[model samples]
Target: MRTRVWDKMIHLPVKYFDEVKTGEMSSRLANDTTQVKNLIANSIPQAFTSILLLVGSIVFML
Candidate 1:
């Protein structure tokens, strides 16, 4: 990704998947991917569930 950003400045050809899974790759993906998964799994469901309950309450009052 960094190389792609600076591709114009450097003349070396770039290729992906060269370091698909290694120490740096695992470190980068482990924390970020877990956080992303938690956000989607827990926060999103809780938000939608709360909204549904709120709408149900309003409809019941009406």
Candidate 2:
């Protein structure tokens, strides 16, 4: 994901680089990728487990 982001950034016109600060871009790259990694690594599995537990409880209750 970081590589893809970097590739996209590299392809952008020089005008964009001139307009945006390097620090801001770096922060955006780091923060956005981290959020995505967290969602995939932590949130998705937790959500799946929660759903499975919910279904199991419902079945056992019935």
Candidate 3:
């Protein structure tokens, strides 16, 4: 998704580029990807690990 956004920005017309600043595009791409990376790297794996541990403990206790 971030790459797609970058490709779109890269192919945009000169008028669009003139109006938009480089820092804004760079920040947008960086932040959006960072947010996605944090979620995938942190939240998703944590949730899966918690679920696995809970299930394993329950089965072992039974």
Segments of candidate 1 deviating more than 4 angstroms: 1-27
Q: Under the 3 Å rule for N, CA and C atoms, how many clashes does model 3 have?
A: 0
lDDT of 2 by residue, 1-62 (tens): 99999999999999999999999999879999999999999999999999999999999999
Prediction-by-prediction clash tally: 0, 0, 0
**Candidate 3, 1-62: lDDT as tens digits:** 78788888889899987998889878989998889989999999999999999999999999
Off by over 4 Å in 3: 8-26
lDDT of 3: 0.90
The list of candidate 2 runs beyond 4 A from truth reads none
From the highest lDDT down, the ranking of the candidates is: 2, 3, 1
| RMSD vs true structure, all candidates | 8.4, 1.3, 3.4
Error of 1 at 39 (Å): 0.8
Rate residue 31 of model 3 by lDDT: 95
The TM-score, computed over Cα atoms with residue i paired to residue i, of candidate 1 is: 0.55
Which residue pairs of candidate 1 clash?
Answer: none
For model 2, name the residue pairs that clash: none
Q: Residues 1-62, candidate 1, lDDT per residue (tens digit)?
A: 33343453245234433634356555555665668778999999999999999999999999
List the candidates ranked by TM-score, beginning with the highest.
Answer: 2, 3, 1
Query: Between candidates 2 and 3, which one is better according to lDDT?
Result: 2
